[model samples]
Target: MPTELRPLGVTCNIQCHYCYQNAQREAGNMGGNYDISKMLQTVDQVGMEFTLFGGEPLLLPLEDLERIWAWGKERFGKNSVQTNGTLITKEHIDLFKKYNVTVGISIDGDGELNDVRWCGNLEKTRTATSKTMSNIELLCESGIYPGIIVTLHRFNASKSRLPRLLLWLECLDELELKSCRVHLLEVETPMQRQLLALTADENIQSLLELYRLERELHHLKFDIFQEMRALLLGLDNKTTCIWNACDPMTTRAVQGVEGDGTMSNCGRVNKDGVDFSKASEQGYERYIGLYYASQEKNGCNGCRFFLMCKGQCPGTAIDNDWRNRSEQCSIWMRLFEEIESDLITQGYNPLSQHAVRAILERYLVQEWTKGANPNLLRLFLHSSATSYEREVMHAYLVENNISHKWSQGKLAHLDHHWEGE
Candidate 1:
């Protein structure tokens, strides 16, 4: 199901160093407030499944959460919550069972890794992580399986750290935890400055190696990195990774409500001067309209990775490097190139598998012999089939000196013949 995330602007107990939300304080109450009833009405109108998130969503008074969950049950039939896990109590577990809410706990890795941010006293962070694990266990005992969202950073992406994490989780296998998800930290803000500034090649190598190891691990049932690797390598023949950010299908299509009730495009975009609470009251349509308008105005269409990126978090786009793709995209694309190069070396032709290599070869030979425009040649190659097919075709065309574009009439005729055949 397509998921929508609603941020409840409630304060979090722990102060993480790299928190994307400027959740530190309520400066003059500028963050604003959201009416839960209005928010629920909007969710109903959108007809999409919703997930509750927050500066720390669990900080929402349990009664408020219950009301939201009940309202959600009445409308969407299923709801979920993403929390830092410190606030989870037996009462929270009971409410989760009553509402059938799926829970996702945000814990980076082990004590050492988690303490990097979940930071206060090292011992306290470890204690909280252990308690959170217990909370996950309690929820599971109640038949509410919880997933862990681990943020990958310079510290946790180590080869040694990943194996340790997997082993630790395996040790906790009796708890019946749902699965663990990992996300690369994006270097888009001051909060991430330290992580971003650490440009050590060793760190990058460790992360890549860890990812490779994670893929080869047999005991783990769920590894997002594996899925990401497959998607990047074009291994998942049926699933196209060219997601439009504005499409409901895009995972990046998220709404973050801050503790102050102000809405931003996503967690990263919830920075200053991007309030949506007023328009949000007008409902989902208005909110989406604003988002799309901002996207277009920002010239995201011109991006090479536009189809895949969909202009991640306009607030981040505006505040930081507006033109930068998500850090995840960079990692994914790098892995994709590596896998594609490896496959090519191994005699696997992605185009041949897609059944377009022959057509592409013919086109490339003809175009090169005729001295066609490189741009036109590329446009034609792209038109012949899928993006991956187009990419392979372009590689062949470039190798043969075929132009990547076409003259208007010639391209039209060629396109007709290609489509007809």
Candidate 2:
């Protein structure tokens, strides 16, 4: 996971109505008054180049950014930052080029579609967006090629607004922007849900359409769908942390660094407040509890896809409650279904093949209680697992050797023997 350094914490220039950081800001977890020395010390101790992240990382002073970037360039070949794009200027672009910094911009859509990213009122919001658009254009003109991040909500990606969203993406494609990370709305409050969140049906249709759009576009790729297909292909490398059974407490998904050089959990899981040594510590409960949970009791049991989905991201958990499975559960399932069918039609041997699916599912749920996302491929290849772990976790062990279908029953019904039985 990439470590993120936040100089300004959750403080942003414009208030997006559905932003996850709002709760942190509300609880007075605002960032500022950071020490450059201490922040550098923390990163050096970790011994890696870090991504400058934020409420809006550009809110940091240019000299401060240059200082950090210079230090980063001296130590590591490259640096990175994920920003809202509104605050980026020509000087900032020059600094970015000097240090070889990779930039990522966050925008929902343009004009009326971006109303959810409210800057006090509609006119101000549009003006802010116009600045962001100009900055994006400037970055492209300067040969920056920043990756685009879009948060899908009713304001931007609803059934009615999707065409406009596509048109905007087409414009980005024309600009030669290649990579886009699309996030489903993280509905944190009742009001946001009602006003901005897409219905489950809407979310499903929007992404399916976007996937088709990706096929036709010369540039512009959605990271999520690509990651999903990668997971099915038994390729665990280079996928997002969400798919790998993220532990809510540890939240190793993204290593977040604070303004004062303290490490923090992923902001999505820190819904109530930004807790650290200053705040009380919470227990490691959610993901572990999921291990023994049964689908019959309204949880992720007997779901063959659990190995790949890992209950999705805990941040998107139902009601913003990490203990519960993701609220977008239905959407993930439908997308996985679509992708798996397509891969099968192409004669690709996806890990989710029915012949070995049940065994892997059964094995993964058992392994979950141990508090980790074990790689199914590693076990399949090396024959290095303990007796039981290697039993049916490998597809060949179950399909090539076993006499019965895993769906028929448990290990008792299809013990690891050749087809002779």
Candidate 3:
């Protein structure tokens, strides 16, 4: 659902005391006013292919991102952004290698473990995190491979600052920088949750030690434990957005757009910024009243991640109340019961397995109260599951031995999305 645009809305340069758009940039809502032909006609009437997000979308100008990446590389061939790599220059890495831009940045680990990214003090937050670790090592030595995020806090996941944030993620995996994303620090108050939060047992031990250094990394991949082992092996991994089923008033995994082009939700629930752009469709009526309210009323009753974490990410819900569930739901239920017991001790069957997770959690509580982001390998890939739910998911993948490999096509290239790490 990538469609960011946002000309300057929570406009930033540095002020990350755990910024979830800092109450819509302290209620004045930072910069604004746009029309570059209504932001390229809201990506040609939301036919979706956009990104250049912000609170710092390189604080716009470099000929306004060279006419927004030359009209997004002539209508979306290759272009994207999402920076905080403190105003990357050298002409913004030559307009991000001319347009094959993909870049993401937002660092939280490196010198001083990036001091809560607050640059109004502490020596301008270590000189803007040493110019964002030298523009993530010159945008990965100019080949331009960015995509790092790293938010977990307490000066970067403490326990002695998480072994220097895993030695700066092994120097961003020696700058080959495959992927990074970790973020659990969404704090925003009580002095950035007592100076940057991270204790649901230090957010499940810094995401189980970044999933045991992502099983001894070869080339840095932590889009949170490879998108939780690609959703417990159902794959189609859409690289983060809090394990799909987010809808803090219709977030639909980071949509934004505005500066004249309108359409917003997902300024991290705009806290109290007042329906930043409320286009209704009853965002799944609080995911059907928290799927039948019971966990002392914060519900997701008997949850085995209720069809891949639906009760999560309403911008860390709970007291922030996007109908409450994730105040980091006990560090994502202890990393989804430790990757569902390491994918059932490597034999697999973890679509949260109880006869295919009680028929996909009663058909995803009526397919997400009608908004639908449902797709567990498209329910055995055909008649969308109704030959008695594909005969109980092919008898629970033949009495649990499991790998039918999505009916032998070997997962025909699973492509779906959610967002974030």
Scored by lDDT, model 2 comes in at 0.77
Q: Top TM-score: which candidate number?
A: 2
Q: Estimate each model's TM-score.
A: 0.65, 0.88, 0.32
Where in model 2 is the C-alpha error above 4 Å? 277-285, 362-367, 382-421
Stretches of candidate 3 above 4 Å error?
1-14, 28-107, 110-112, 124-164, 168-181, 184-223, 233-241, 250-267, 275-282, 285-345, 349-362, 370-387, 397-421
- In model 2, which residue pairs have backbone atoms overlapping below 3 Å? none
TM-score of 3: 0.32
Which scores higher on lDDT, 1 or 3? 3
lDDT of 3 by residue, 1-421 (tens): 6788888777787888778887876777675666778877877687677888878877777898888888888887788888888779889898888887888888888778888788898998898889888988988788887888888887777898898898779878877788887778776577878867867898798889888986677788886776776676555346466667676766776677778777887877677866466567645777777778876778788787766776767787878887867778778878888888987886766777656777766776776666675666664454346667776776665555444545443233333332323
For model 1, the superposed segments whose C-alpha errors exceed 4 Å read 1-7, 23-34, 158-163, 172-178, 189-191, 195-206, 215-223, 226-252, 257-263, 270-273, 276-319, 326-330, 341-348, 351-421
| Candidate 3 overall lDDT versus native | 0.75
Answer with 1 or 2, whichever has the higher lDDT. Answer: 2
lDDT (tens digit, per residue) of candidate 1 on 1-421 = 3344444453467766666654324342233355776676666655677788766777777888899888777776777988888789989888888887888888876567676556478788888877876777777778887787776665665555656655665644546564666555645556565653234343455456655654455443345444433332222222222222222211234654433333345444434433433232211221223223433354332232222233433333433543433334444445545554654675554332333434543453344344331222243433446556555554644443334453432333222111101
